[model samples]
Target chain A: MIRAALFATAALALPTHAAAQETPNMPAATSPSPGVWIPRMQARAYLLENDQTLLEQDLRIEHGLARDLSMWAELPLYEGFLDAPRPSDGEFGLGALEAGIELRVLQHDLDAIDTVRGAVFAGAALPTATDGFGRQSLDPFVGAAITAIFGRHGVNAAARYTFVTGDTDLPLFIGDDGEDVIGADLGYAFRLAPAAYGEERVAAWYLTLELNGAFTAEGDREVLFAPGLLVEAPTYAVELGVQLPIAQEGSDRPEIDLGIFAGLRLLY
Target chain B: MRHPILIGACLCAAHLLAPSCTSTASTPTAVTMSYSAEPLAAGEHELEVHGMSCPKCVSNVDLQLKRLPGVDAAVVDMKRGVVTITLSGNARPSARDLATAVSDAGFTLRAIDRGAQGGTP
Candidate 1:
């Protein structure tokens, strides 16, 4: 009886290799992974009403703090034709500093070929204008974003609400009332090159179209359409885009007709 | 400074064709593609994972697996989507516990293979 008991104990102690079981498809995970920082710089040129123009640049950095949490910050510089017909003598100064944190709430791997990701974020824009560039008030905002990926094609939709807090009586183009902004980005990635299994790197090219719309509590509204291209690798990506205003309301305010943007992001 | 449109156009055209024009040396190398395993411990396990598409995903699994209580080391192979985990001496976690860790890292564990002595290569 003691020998039989010892045999049973040995049998149970043997290694157990679990067989492969079919798992239900889960949601898609983010590409950059967690614990990485991506820093990007964007420059824009805007064609405003009355043949005036605005040139703006932004340096943005984002970090994935955890699997479902991330943070970001941005510094903006602005140059605009404050005086008519003197494009060379326009006001050039710093605009605003913005920061935010995001928490991913849902991610679903629909199948082998599809994924969905969603997140919500809260942000603040601090008044850091040098002279004639930005609003002189603190603005806090909340936003949500969702991305659906189908193999190489993807779509991103985001909406943000800003609560304006200071100097609401400024010019319409600079400061209005609290506003709502909505945007959508659609992209398709082409594997221009493939990396071997043991190779250290890979590359992909993408074409994207973005539609941005904004509405202010004071009845101001506008829409912009942008088309862009992107080339991304493991640690770096470059993007260029052109924005054209497709719709607008409130004629007395300065309006942007066309704009261009180019940016690069570096990961570490 | 003078003609923003011309500069922008030139920059865009150059960037669009740069990837195809340049070789791999110019592209950023993949990060965290390989893992160096530590010396084997007593309670080691190997998992066959699925749905890892890039090196970044490998890193994600690595981070999560290392967070487990008894996990001493975790190595992930992006190409094979395999994960090998080592637990400290006298520390043993069930196969289901490991499967849950992989799942929490947004991956699927297809199979769990344990060694005779609870250590897997």
Candidate 2:
């Protein structure tokens, strides 16, 4: 089955570079190039399956400290069936707490409508969750990301590795073998509205497609294709997307049939 | 299995329905004046900044410039990529300071004019 903690961690792993510049399922390496200090808040919900329904709500906050540095944290609350047809009432509680920092290593503004950037990030997941929801250990992770923007088209890619510290006897999802986890994602976003840039502030709409993959040291692999829509203003954004598993190989847990997510982000 | 075609159709529908939500105008013309590294005088100053394509970009430049000492206000003409800064009395912020502020906001300061009147110098 889908482990609530693992799902939550994967969903909230990366920090956004700008107010609404990131894709829904992946991180953007671009820094907050247009703001000195921008703080952002996002509330996201996900619905997925193992053999039963899994619903999770994630709250995230990010702050840009400088032109090339940013930090973020996330907390998740989950409600779902922990097992197949067991615990008929279902279970509800908090998941792991994760925090991270990203530093832009390279940024080149090619012109008014084109740019490239790269960043590296590191953080840890703290074991602060209700029973049957957390790893009960501190997990450290590191990753790098890159972004490129040309006119109305943008690309983002990131890869991360997380080192699981402890093991549990509970019917865990992935990483129960104390093996590390690896994840990678690539996303493309195309501006669908305001086909061109102008003087006045306008709400921007984007169509995004992404490929997200996860692998474990114990030969578990899963790859999902996610397509999403985003409506972004200067101060806030609304996003909705759905994920479909295209590949599931050697997975020790239940296969994920489908996943849906929606989120709202506010910038200050 | 999930219906990929259905999801794609929904996304397309959403985009098509929102065609009139935002303007589709092209980029505005920008001032192309050159600036010298001379000392800035107290009063109003205009700066030509580069790589500002959105309102948020203008806001960032405005906020950073206003944070500088003696800067009373900063107004951005996004179409022209020019920022007009009002300086308080006795404010002697140099051209380098203005450039630095723009750089800190993730853009480049291309030119600066000391007075409100436009001239080629």
**Judged by lDDT, which candidate is best?**
2
Residue B51's lDDT in candidate 2: 62
- Residue A181 deviation, candidate 1, in Å? 5.3
iRMS per model, in Å, is: 14.8, 11.6
lDDT of all predictions:
0.54, 0.65
lDDT of 1 at A60: 63
Q: DockQ for the candidate 1 complex?
A: 0.05
List of clashing residue pairs for candidate 1 = A26-A109, A27-A108, A27-A109, A28-A108, A28-A109, A200-B30
Give the per-residue lDDT digits (tens) of candidate 1, residues A55-166.
7766566676765567888787666664443323555577779898876665554443245666666677898855556466777766666666555565666676666665
Quote the positional error of residue A21 for candidate 1 in Å: 31
Off by over 4 Å in 1: A1-35, A82-90, A110-113, A167-201, A251-253, B1-121
List the TM values for chain B, per candidate. Answer: 0.55, 0.61
Measured with DockQ on alpha carbons, how good is candidate 2?
0.12
